[model samples]
Target: MKEYVLLLFLALCSAKPFSRPSYMTLKNMMLEDMEDSDDDDDDDDDDNTLFPTRTPANPFFPFDMLPTCPFGCQCYSRVVHCSDLGLTSVPSNIPLDTRMVDLQNNKIKEIKENDFKGLTSLYGLILNNNKLTKIHPKAFLTTKKLRRLYLSHNQLSEIPLNLPKSLAELRIHDNKVKKIHKNTFKGMDALHVLEMSANPLDNNGIETGAFEGMTVFHIRIAEAKLTSIPKELPSTLLELHLDYNKISNVEQEDFKRYKDLQRLGLGNNRITDIENGSLSSLPRIREIHLENNKLKKIPSGLQELKYLQIIFLHSNSITKVGVNDFCPAVPKMKKSLYSAISLFNNPVKYWEVQPATFRCILSRMSVQLGNFRK
Candidate 1:
């Protein structure tokens, strides 16, 4: 019986070309390469745990009644791969013990309430590149353990309601989401990463208390229609990318609450000026990306950030590089030296800039200053 099961497992493995190796495949490969010795008993015990044996006392018991893989999908261990299958709806035959399901690149339109009825152990769901426009409020009620969800490149205009509170990452990029209600993320205390870029989100669309209950650390709202920074973001954010927007200026109070921010991206916008002390609010910022804007000079407060390493200021209208623009006059106060400072494509004359301007830079190559042709 053990040999029969081994043969069946190998046959299933070789039946398809998997895009990526599943956990079971890697484990089995490692087992095969290990030297056979006195540890064979331990290996056999592990194998039995993975593929259990039928009880000899009840020989007529239906041992093969376990839930099988969906018709056109591949199932191995606790993962189900149904991506790129042109599936119009969720498959009903998914095993009860499935931990992850890949249904990306499908034609599925909407998720019905019972689509994932009994999947209590489900941990992740990938539904990217689908035609999903609506999802039933209780569609994910059974998947309480779900942690990661990918709904990018869908037709949804708003976030799905009643999402599993256990979700840690939610990617809804390239959607039509315009408005965000206050209770959109109410019970999601475990959420940390949110990627909602490439949406048509309005500046006032994010209602107050939109992120009140969450402690999200990373948020990317790039390529949106925001005219000004939304003040409704959680203060626990570490990385905030707002590139490719219509924002015109960075007010002093724009980031007053984000004191723990480490990286801020404002590239490819219409920003013409940054208030004198605006960037100083984020005392712990390590990187700032403000390239491809209409700024005429370096944004102030760069000299106050001791941990700042990279500053992308290229493709701007800056006309000069002051000696104290990036580095503080006192070297002992800087906790980290500048690694990369880009100022290319700006109107600043590189020859007129003194060599002492970049004295605190790690290397000469770290400062990019040429290519200012009009």
Candidate 2:
């Protein structure tokens, strides 16, 4: 009876791959290479389709001490997530049906083409915090179904030519990258979030159409050594993070096409002068962070920003005063627009127009506001 069941199991395995290496088999196989890697296959190993009974040589030990697979590995199931492992080499013989592979915090030196070949069902591939020097052409060529690819905190000097077309989120933060290839993310039609923060993308942060296919919510280039905003971005980005960059100047034309941008973080830089019409066209802007830099004068037409909610202008050398500077207005603006304004630490000590800033700050407050004399 047992032999019949074993035969049926073996037949099933040959017809389709096993869901995964059974726990007992993984414990035994991962410890040592299978003895059946030889010429003639052993029928006994096949008979015990799930696991062969191992005599208790030593008491059961935790499964953590197994031989470490090299980097660029493919763990087949949710059971094999790679997090914070200090591995240095790409492992061989990865499980083919891996759904989510966390290659985060490993010392993977290279990413060759088709490195993830067998992992056809890969969903999330995290390559964060690795010593990755280069990603070979077609490294993720066939990984068509990938949702998120996190390659942050690595030493990637160059940009990937063609990221996966099916990718939704890509986070490549804090690296030694300078420029993004014009065709960097060329054919990627469905890309949404691109977080390239804290890299030394030196003057040419991202080339025109660098984000060719993204029609998503945000595009953050914060903390990257850039002096100004990249003019050529997707027409639909809602939140733009150009904060902590080396931006010293911004005119109205620079932000003309960004009509859809809502949250703009241009704080922590050297933007002292705001042209009269600099933020005139951005009506949809809600939260604007222009704090911690230099600003002597802000525009009056900025009051046209009807959706302006939060304005953060702290630690700036702003010495000018105007109601529109803090609370940019919109057409037929409701009393419920501007919510919070934090200019708590500005250079001007006495404020004749302090109450208006308070009004803009409390714009979003649903409760009745306390009136402070200007």
Candidate 3:
């Protein structure tokens, strides 16, 4: 038995030892096994499987497939923020699917024709606080879907031609724009809000029928050189702000065409007198801002407005507040009570004014008075 055991041990030692398969051979075997398993599982319900139908080519997943963001800019989803980078021009690599591009506070001087090309999905473009002096006529031809455009605080001398007809809101305030051509806003039927304040615009600078094609509701031409309200303005205006202008008086016909105007702002102007029936046409007016002007007395037609709620007449030369200045004797005729009446810094004597003068106001605190300093 010992001799037999010794011989078996020697035979085992001399024979080739059992070894593990090589890595490639084991990998091939595993692949074959997976293929056989997949073939067998193909008959089973795919929804009940433990693994996916196919593996994704990218290991980092969905983010790796997104369009590349521009350098020195931040992009997320469909909005690209490229503000305050001192960029000389619009970045060329803006994604095709971008919805909004904020390029404000840059040094960009001009917008070439192809600057915003191929961005059909774009909705808003903010070029505020830039040095933009010129925009190519066809610069916005491709961005037909753009709605809100902010070009404020720039050096633009005129409204850019070929603006997107789908535009709804346009802010070109604090620019060098002096003139508005007749066809500047042509075909822009969707435009509603236009802010062109702090420009050098005068009445003559606006050509006839300049605003004929648009149905804009809110227009702000404040801090400009306008001496009188432009008659060429659209009659569809709901809010008209000409504050900080050189307007001397409110004529009877100044607001006749603006019968739909709800809010009127003529504050910080040179207005000394308002005609007797100047505000009678604005039956729907809710607020009137006439502060910081040279008016001698309250305008005549306030009591007739049934919906007038707020009136700002502070910092004027008015010395009296009549009991009927703001409200009619029959209070039931007025649809809305005065919410605010500002008369401070005028020469009016507070004690002399009767308490009944503010009977139509909602609250006594809403009536501001008695802070006159010569």
Q: Give lDDT tens digits, candidate 1, residues 117-203.
A: 999999999999999999999999999999999999999999999999999999999999999998999989999999999999978
lDDT of 2 by residue, 223-269 (tens): 97788767778878888898888888887787788888888999898
Clashing pairs in 1: none
Flag regions of model 3 displaced more than 4 Å.
1-65
Best lDDT among the predictions, by candidate number: 3
List, residue by residue over 1-374, the lDDT tens digit for candidate 3.
Answer: 99999999999989997886665665565556557666766776553344556542333323434478889999875799999998999999999989999999999999999999999999999999999999999999899999999999999999999899999999999999989998889999999999999999999999998998789999999999999878878999999999999999788989888888999999999999999999989999999999999999999989999999999999999998898999988989899999999999999988999888888888878899998999
TM-score of each: 0.85, 0.73, 0.83
* Model 2: lowest-lDDT 10 consecutive positions: 365-374
The global C-alpha lDDT for each of the candidates, from Candidate 1 onward, is 0.89, 0.70, 0.91
Per-residue lDDT, model 1, residue 130, is 98
**Residue 299 lDDT in candidate 3:** 92
Candidate 1 has its poorest 10 consecutive residues by lDDT at 54-63
Global lDDT of model 1: 0.89
- Which has the higher lDDT value, candidate number 2 or candidate number 3? 3
